[model samples]
Target chain A: MDTIIIDERIDVGAVFKKNIIKPRWFVWKGRKYAITEVTYTWEDTQGAARVMHFALSDGNTLFEVSLNLTSLEWRLEKSSVV
Target chain B: MTRTILLIDMNAFFASVEQAMNPALRGKPIIVCGRGRTVVTTASYEARVFGVKTGMNLYQAKQACPQVIAVEGDMSRYIDASHNIQRIAREFTDQVEMFSIDECFLDVSKTCRNEVDPQNIARAIKHTIREKLGVTCSIGIGPNKVVAKIASKMQKPDGLIEIREKDIPVLFALMAVQKLQGVGVGRHISEKLMSMGITTAGQLGNTPLEKLMHHFGIMGYRLKRIGEGKDDSPVDSSGGNELIKSVGHSHTFPRDTRDISIIRSYMMMLTEKVGLRLREYGLMGKTVYCTIRFGDFTSWGAQQGLKEHIRQNREIFFVAEQILARAFPLSKAVRLVGLSISDLKPRDTQQFLLKEMEKDTTLAEAVDDINKKYGVFTIKASSVILSEKFGIRPSCGMVSKQALKIKV
Candidate 1:
């Protein structure tokens, strides 16, 4: 269960005051359901900064968010590809 | 029995709290604003269809929409989403009031005692802020608080409307004599009330409030009681509990600058952050004011008063560097800079007979105890670390601008 998408002018409270919260997912739509409010920023325009973790929820109804330390690429769903 | 008063507001609030947290910023456009180099402190409506707005700047909001999406303001995440919508507007009323930080008001006339329904308690406070702050608000309902803040901006983002008292003269006859509120009007009194045909707010409530006080004085008796929804004003629950006559800080220079030494090093770091929040609110003002804004967004502000009541950040950066050297005019290029202070008092002043002002209040209590234990500039004032090495500092608590994760 992973779906992260966030983008639009970043900063969900400076990415929840600089990330670290994951008790294995459950974040859905309306902006990954406001990732428990605040923290998010992904800059680079002479502003110099790039970071991630948008996992608000992907545990169903397809609502996920990403930014968990940049470098991303994924596609999996063969019964959670065991 | 006129008293329901809702208000609510929020839409486009920091781009709907950054599109409720970022479903690819839902239908794009955003903006947010204010981190320095000023203007545009709220845009989205898909960046107001590319003309972009809220105080403009950010280089004319990236020349009116270069794929908008700016974002900067946070104000502690909109004051923690206005303390979780003032904790669900204190479950419908302790007569709420917050009023700014994306507005709020409530009253709920004795908790809807005359049997609920201020438009279903503004749709149960917009479904308890969309099932607990997923965002979207609007709300309005009215009986006061200036017709519930003009029926909470008349609607957008989860609207609710209400007006009553026989729909205040058909909603002040389809609004607009500058949306008839306080008629701050201008654009030359909306081109002299649209060349005297006076467009709307029912033709300025049928004109003659003595010819709008013979051409606007006392803002034409407050635009004939804001075109008759008549305000009585109340709702000031003294959150700031008065006496802070002033204490300011301003910035607006993400660019445009004809440097008067970078606007006196951002007016000595916003008069050293309004003299460290007026010596951490022990207080002491005696006036100071000093605004600016230029690059055509026009703004000026001045104030003076002093002769004492200081709180020293080198006397509020030499009275905001002599009111930005006689209210600016080094022709163009400034973007903004402010630093208020105003009359206030309370710092229990008494120990003065002077010994070099008790060695400058023991060097401002040893630079406010090493900037409150190694935090702020950690013991500043060598001309505030040479005005933060020639100014514009305030990056507000950095941890490389956090973003480790939570993009959901």
Candidate 2:
């Protein structure tokens, strides 16, 4: 997969269940998309900042999203469709 | 009494992980490769069927299978999967030796309970790996590691085989002598053995030891034991599961160059990678080694030991440059340059270096912190800043979960 590093900030809504964080919806580029399923979840560390990377599907498109814990910011790191 | 050993080999590991994570890549011909690299690191079963094999350049792989999809390999994903697999293996036996990123050996002799057969344990391990990891593996159960390793490769994709002592003679009678593990005596010796009418493992095993030793020296004894399906090596699981021998990185230039500046910059970049890994693992080494592969494929390496153990980029690069200079006055253009630090020991106490050393240590810590927070290369030494400009990407070779010791 070609990983395009897009560090632009985006809006994300997540749910905390049983100490697990799941992304429910996200907004990017003035568009709101509801996540249908999360294909994979992984944790990455950047210095002291911990980021949660989620490969989520919005029914038609697959997007890779990252949430920075220290900054509490969400970024769309990559996308599989186009 | 024979001890039970099991070898678990992941099928097309990198490609399989890519397929497992991406639904779009499933069942399609895929080849995992480094960016701008022609060599195929791993090929899916779909691509392999069309004659695409590991180490085949992209041009050759495409020639064999035009529809092959090339994906840049992500070492982190493979490393994570390997850790999960190792955890699964530990559920059966604590004696799990991670052979590589995609293979491991487990000594289940002590853990094989009275009611369950050794084969059953292998089956359970395979089942859990498939269900949890969404990947398949072939497992081989044998009286020892060598036989288990050979049996693991007997079937492709997903296979299970058990090799008993009684099965050795018949199973190896038709097997090529070269198929035996640790028999890589090269083509000349293989040809000599073939000339002696020793083409099969059974023949090699049955050959007189004195004659074999007279022909091949000490290696002949190892060959005989491997041919007889005997391996006395134990599965080592000390040091939190993975035993790391060395931390190093090597980059092959797209075009062979003789420019000293370019080569030095590449060396600096590699030393940074090695140093980062060393500090990450809380390890330090006394020896600095450098390797240079010329355009003719002939390689030369040199190493030097330091009185003080080091895990900093500047120190590693300084020592590596010294070693490289010792092998200098290049006879030809350099194709690849690699740096590694061996003779490793855990970092314990620091020696006082007065002002300069303390300043360097503080700077290194700050830089490491920033890079670890942002991403690698977010902050790098000025000497290595041109590494990306020169297309000197960090090499990802056989990443093991044990290598990445993430501190939680």
Candidate 3:
């Protein structure tokens, strides 16, 4: 359920819409992760959407779930986080 | 109708700036100078009450007021605050002349009418500087430039004095002769005036101009006119044709000493500072001058014109040191040593002999570029390090071979 809770907060649709998914690597409340999938809610609610993903650079770690924009406030983005 | 001119001088600019930033320094005796072994650039009015003053050696100032808090002078902050005050002055009139970093002359003739009070304008300037810049200034209003300058100094910080043309004799009666401009030129003339029982401006003004001239030549005629308030000098804001006339620096030691090594070391440091600035500004000078102030407050200056314009640190040091070598007593302790380079020319087109020296010229230009990009002290001569002194180290000191390209 906690993993599901984490999955729900990171909305893929909003991340893609705001261009925050690419080039971003960060930890949330001490959980290290990376964005892998972004999806849209609908055309009418243009900004509000959902996301599906895993944690890795160059497709190394496996994660799968659906997330909504209404939950998590934001995510971190950096030029080169290594 | 007599036009009123106001001269406003800020009290202890740098120290006051610090005090204004920090609430605790208010009413405290403070001297703003360089941290170790430097001249007191500005002394608070509290410190001045005890005979401490700007240009007095730090040790001498400490002798005058032992408890004075000495702060290193910050010219940048003072310049910022000065620009603010200058902006405020422009709100009143465009005819404002900056006399010094902390002093200004405002020609309010157009703004002030016959019945309109000049005191109101003085109070406005004072209040504006205090409220806006957190500093105070003394204002003096008089009929002419000399009288206005003297009147402004008559009062202390935040005080104002006004002298009208009709009241010149009355004002002259109460003031000493030294208070008049140009009266302290010679000792014998003062004694002669004293012998005649004409010891004040009023008495001197009463003395016929012809008799005064007979005693002191043309200067006597000038003195009589000054005594009677006949100064016609204008407040020239442009400082016309004085294009950076002389660039010089003087530093006072913590203690006075006659050691040639120490004196030469300080002069060398000063010479390098001036030389670097000359090169940075693309200027070279033919005339180099040196000044020495003794412990007794007596001073002497000597200058010589070089055969060619030079900007090298060694060249400036050599000329200044040579002058001092011939002029210095070698016995009397020196409190201050100053160096100035004048009669400047653009370094790019300077004529020179010797092929290697000309090559060195190109090298100097390249080094100047490096220093400008990476910051000063990025590149310096080995002689500068060999003759290292206890002053500013000349830069941020972060060395990198990679050139920092600054966009013009």
The model with the greatest DockQ is 2
Query: Residue B329 of candidate 2: its Cα lDDT?
Result: 81
Better of 2 and 3 by TM-score: 2
lDDT of 3 by residue, B1-408 (tens): 567788888877777876674444568888877544457878888899999988897789989999887765434346556656677777777777776667778888877775668889988989988887678888989877777877887888778999888878888887777666432335666677778788888888789988899988998877787777767777765532235565677766656777777777778767756776787667889999998888888988899998988888777888897898887565578877788999988775747678888887778677766765554556775544433553442221111111111111
Q: Poorest 10 consecutive residues of model 3 chain B by lDDT?
A: B399-408
Tens-digit lDDT track of model 1 for B331-359: 77777777788788778667868799879
Model 2 docking grade:
acceptable
Model 3 / residue B327 / CA error / Å: 5.3
Report per-candidate TM-score of chain A alone: 0.24, 0.87, 0.26
In candidate 3, the residue pairs with backbone N, CA or C atoms under 3 Å apart (3 or more residues apart, or in different chains) clash, namely A12-A50, A12-A51, A13-A50
Q: Give one digit per residue, the lDDT tens place, for model 2 in A1-82.
A: 4555566789999998997889999998898999998877666566668777787888766778888889988999777642
**Position B86, candidate 1: lDDT:** 69
Q: How accurate is candidate 2 locally (lDDT)?
A: 0.82
Range of the 10 consecutive residues with the lowest summed lDDT in candidate 1 chain B: B399-408
**Colliding residue pairs in candidate 2:** A46-B372, A46-B373, A47-B372, A47-B373
Error of 3 at B57 (Å): 6.9
- For each candidate, report what fraction of the true interface contacts it reproduces: 0.00, 0.40, 0.00
User: How much lDDT does each candidate structure score?
Assistant: 0.64, 0.82, 0.66
Per-candidate iRMSD: 12.2, 3.1, 25.2
Interface Cα RMSD for candidate 2?
3.1
